[model samples]
Target: YDSCVNSVSDPSIFVIFEKHQVYPEYLIQYTTSSKPSVTPSILLALGSLFSSRQ
Candidate 1:
């Protein structure tokens, strides 16, 4: 059970958009996931981080 939960929570499932040039329009497509592996807070944090670089 622990292993299954850990696997599901694995943040690696999300693509590192910061590594590539991405526009706001396509951000939804990359961030959307059917598995619900990521939380909205995490996405907001990443969004701020990426925006800070620009």
Candidate 2:
């Protein structure tokens, strides 16, 4: 839950959940696949955040 993270990507909570390592089913509840259109850069940014957290 970082303030800076809120504004990044699509501003969708689903993106944030994936960033935090949540399950895809969980994401489905919050968002549909039709939206957000996953991108490599978003994953990279989340990966960086994950490693930093560890």
Candidate 3:
């Protein structure tokens, strides 16, 4: 998913995901507790990045 990662402008986050999920099952717990959807968080991240650069 090169396009997806590039779209984020933050491939390292995915890299961490790929490398660091020491316990795969914990991902389930983490996701369950996280925002219902990633869209809002991703939008917030993009907004912050753009705002900071300006």
lDDT (10s digit) by residue, model 1, range 1-54: 112222545643433335444344544435555785889999999999999995
Candidate 3 residue lDDT tens string, 1-54: 222344465455433344444445444333345547668889999999999994
Best-to-worst ranking by TM-score: 2, 1, 3
Model 1 residue 10 CA deviation in Å: 41
Pairs in steric clash, model 2: none
> TM-scores of all models?
0.33, 0.34, 0.29
**Cα error of candidate 2 at position 1, Å:** 62
Candidate scoring better on lDDT of 1 and 3 = 1
RMSD of each: 21.3, 21.9, 16.4
Question: What do the candidate models score in CA lDDT, each in turn?
Answer: 0.57, 0.61, 0.56
Off by over 4 Å in 1: 1-36
Estimate the overall C-alpha local distance difference test score of candidate 1: 0.57
Clashing pairs in 1: none
**Which ten contiguous residues of candidate 2 have the minimum total lDDT?**
14-23
